[model samples]
Target: MISASSQQKKQLQKYTMLEGERKQGQFPLLEMSHLLYGGKDQFDKFLERQNFFDTNPMFKVNHDFYNKSRQDQILLNAERTVEAMKKLSLGDPNYYTPNVLCPQGIFISTVHFAMVIPAFQVLASDDQITKWMTSLKNFSAIGCYAQTELGHGSDVQNLQTVAVFDKQTTEFVIHTPNIEATKFWPGELGLYCEFALVFAQLQVDGKGYGVHPFWIRIRDKETHKPLSGIEIGDIGPKMGYAVKDNGFMSFDHFRAPLDSLLNRYIKVSRDGKVERQGNPKVGYGSMMYMRNILCDQYTKFGGRALTIAVRYSLYRKQFKDDNKQEIRILDYQLQQQKLFPLLAEFYACVFGSIKIKELVNDNFNRISQSNDFSLLGLTHAVLSGAKANYTYFVSNCAEWCRLSCGGHGFAHYSGLPIIFFEMSPNITLEGENTILNLQLARYLLKQLQHIVSKPSAVPEFFKFLSLETVKVDDVTTIDNLIKLLGLNCAILTKYAAQKLMTHSDMKESWDTKSGIALAKAASTFIPYFNMLCFLDTINNKAKETKEILTILARIYGITMLLNNMQGLLLKNQLNSQQIKTLQDTRESLYPIIRTNALCLVEAQGLSDNSLQSLIAPKEGDVYMNMYNFASKENSLNKQQVHNGINYIQKMREVNAKL
Candidate 1:
């Protein structure tokens, strides 16, 4: 372990911690990631591939082929990106973001892997899967998730693009008959993908049957040219994700073989009978699945920022004593206030993400085996809302971390600008947060209606919203605090659910009025969920570990209760004295936690390499090396320059002249 003896050495060690530690299992702060996600085989091979892909061939392929002639580049990059993907062994889940960003065109296709593929797996007929799945996986062809159109994105039922049946050839003729019908915001359609899973109005024998995904090849695989009757190109730049080339496309009369339709859940027979295997919403399963993975994605972004900020804060020095000795920025309470909450948040997010991943996997398994979709459907709404909320919150936190570093934070070298830029698009992608939150509201409303009809069907968690009772445990241990917080989270959801049910017709109006509050209510689950994870870990461990975890539990609950004061007040959940007790407990826990901050961050399992800060050291080096670097760099001399009368008098003279 690096020495923490000198302030200067400690500062220099901060940034170096994230550099290569992810590969070493030294940074993620979690002790049980191996058990939760998989073994070292899962993580190590991924790191190896990340290194390979970040190097020459992939870089050249992305830069020369994808960035140069974006129109033509799109087609080429699609092939190249697929080729790279084919090289992966698929033995492990490879989740590394390349050190360099892929062009938006490519990021779009990559995201499609997360956003759309699961739906195809679940929704496509066996034959349909057999014909395309292998090639799709092997990258013989590239595809896009084309659901959102210029005319209507969130409202799936009202899409303008139509896929009409041509009974004569047993084919589907896809057409964007109007300007609005043109597919918009598809990632690779402008240039890369040869095929797309077009979400079009499935018109069978002149009757519209809402939106359905049809796999249609848009380009010739051999010649790399757009197929007959297809128009696609870039949609131009936006606030972020410039590297991802979001593109627009339209079809004049594109034709596909009859079996091209993804007919897993809902299908049209050769005779034009619309046979339903399941609810159409099941088609949304893949999207919801991506939203779940995005929970981890958000945590990653937040964790990376925290890693940088923590190290940078340690390295950066400000005001000095009369002896002119510089002090680490982290020594200040103001800096602590700005960053420690986020530091705590980083830990919270990792645990929360693991929990969400477990939930996702459980739901996927249950849905895969039993095909009983009630839980899947509920999770779809709830998970998406949770993902949207947590990701947005983390993004904001990361940017604030950047800002807290002042000028150095804006520098790309500090890792904040790219981090900030990279995180912004998460708010709109997969599904816009506003629209997704409404989906949650809708789901909650449905649950409320179910409870009204059959009270026994409601989960115990929703009992608070039942209007009939208020029954929580009389005990108030830390465990109970966690439990009550869980109950509080469920109650908040139920409250919103009941209102949504009571004013079902006013969903849009209520969404407009109470949307932010509803989002807040949805997000309340994160801290509550986080507290449970920590407590669960504690309860499973030795006594001393439990004691340490108890402090975090108190901190987590008290912090949350303070934030949601309105809920506590409106629901009469806690008395005034209890609220004060929570606050007092929180204050008492702060110093106890402060001493353990570095140890806590270490337990998160994030690598020093990924942190990209010099001050936060790895296993080998910490404060001594940083102090040496700082002393040798002569930062104290620079401080003397600032204090020198010559420099000060020059500055004063200039100011007086001005």
Candidate 2:
């Protein structure tokens, strides 16, 4: 009888529960993983790299990473950086980027590989790349991107750091003219980086040539100290990126060699003559390249948080059921209500980002291969909005996922809090989201103006500007929802554009009254694009998994439509009945989706180590691990009674019996 009860207990264990969920999955797991990771080869690489870290004792994480002090974390980060560079097989160009084997969030040298080197690849000449790219990519030298200033974060045109061409010495004198001009907030710049791709105003013969990227050695190789005439140190204490040293710098008229000027677009001669090969506007593109790439990465970043939350929800139980047995929290409709749409939305974001990444790569190729920058404006506009909206979506939902896990999410052991804090910075990074929203609006207005004058010349992407029909009937259909959103975009864009046109000075108009409207307009455009991406992926890529994907798509499409339909409702573009239908359609999906929750989240392919959570072990034994980690590994647990010096003897005297 005891053995039977034991077996029954084993059957009810979360391990068995989660395993059962996995078995109930509608589609094959490997097939889904292959699709999510892009393809078979890519997924294989992910496994290979993931396995390397998984098996390697050196990469094993111990202790609560959250409890680590800044200094300790920084030291550990640096050590890991070196170890990863030594053990990993990287440097295969696009096939094996350096950060591929790295952690999800920012590391000590992330900016070097992700931002600094990529900047040099596009902005640096071929010879410059040949000289420095290998060493940087190989982790021999650390670098950072320095662009934002103390006074100016978004206004690139009005930056105060200047690099004046000194023809006599064949050097550029880089200087910070005022305190406000101090270069600030470059990751890894404080304690680690030896070099920086600094953005400063280019002045040759006392004639300004706009701001440009200059490769400069900021720190000594041997001493690892800031070089002469360079002031560099960490900006102490931030909400996140504790391991990363976001730094500040000021140049005391530091003289850099003539070769420091990244001359891919414009060349500077020894005699101080400037040869401009590309338009001045191309400088803006150089800065935006990293921001554009960041758009696609948020979804992947968000998957880490979702994985932990979803897995934990599956294991966590609450009040007993009618059968006098505890039901898993996931059984509650409220829990499903909170998490199912996010799961669907996560997949939707991934599909959309995949398509956006392709466009970004294509636009980059056009600029490099053919010197064709015709699509530059459109690319900038699309990415500005995407980066802004996608970051917000990921950050917002990540927090939502955290809250859905109830009180356990508050524990750093859950890995939820850290992910939320780290992700919070992305909304303001690259370009501040608010500024980017207006930047996107500015780009759309340009396109809108073109379409207004010449109907035939309206670009297909901007053809949404011509969409006037709004459908309230049959709006529950995915295609109809998409069309209605396009119509909404048209209305918002044209309305904001009209507001700007009322004044001769567009900037003044945008700054005063229409900025909020334009921001709304830009935010509206992103989901429209995402839905488009979703439809494309469904049609072309996901035919085999279409059954599950169809449900997911409808859920995502409906939530997005509902989110944006308030304005439409106020304007009578959408009726209450249609809105209710869309919401009802979304609700109907929760049950089917809750059944497949494990399949959907696991498809993202987040590993246990990558998650780094006590509450979310892949084995589904969450509580035991949480207890062991907190009671055993936590620093306070080193002593039976932490810091109770006077009470130690008294406490021991009282604990006579067990």
Best by TM-score: 2
Candidate 2 residue lDDT tens string, 78-97: 77766766766433333232
Off by over 4 Å in 2: 1-12, 89-105, 280-289, 540-544, 644-658
lDDT of 2 at 477: 73
lDDT value, residue 364 of candidate 2: 75
lDDT of 2 at 310: 79
Task: Provide the overall lDDT of each model, using Cα atoms, as 2-decimal numbers.
Answer: 0.64, 0.78
Off by over 4 Å in 1: 1-87, 90-92, 96-109, 269-271, 279-281, 321-324, 445-455, 460-477, 483-520, 542-545, 575-581, 604-609, 612-658
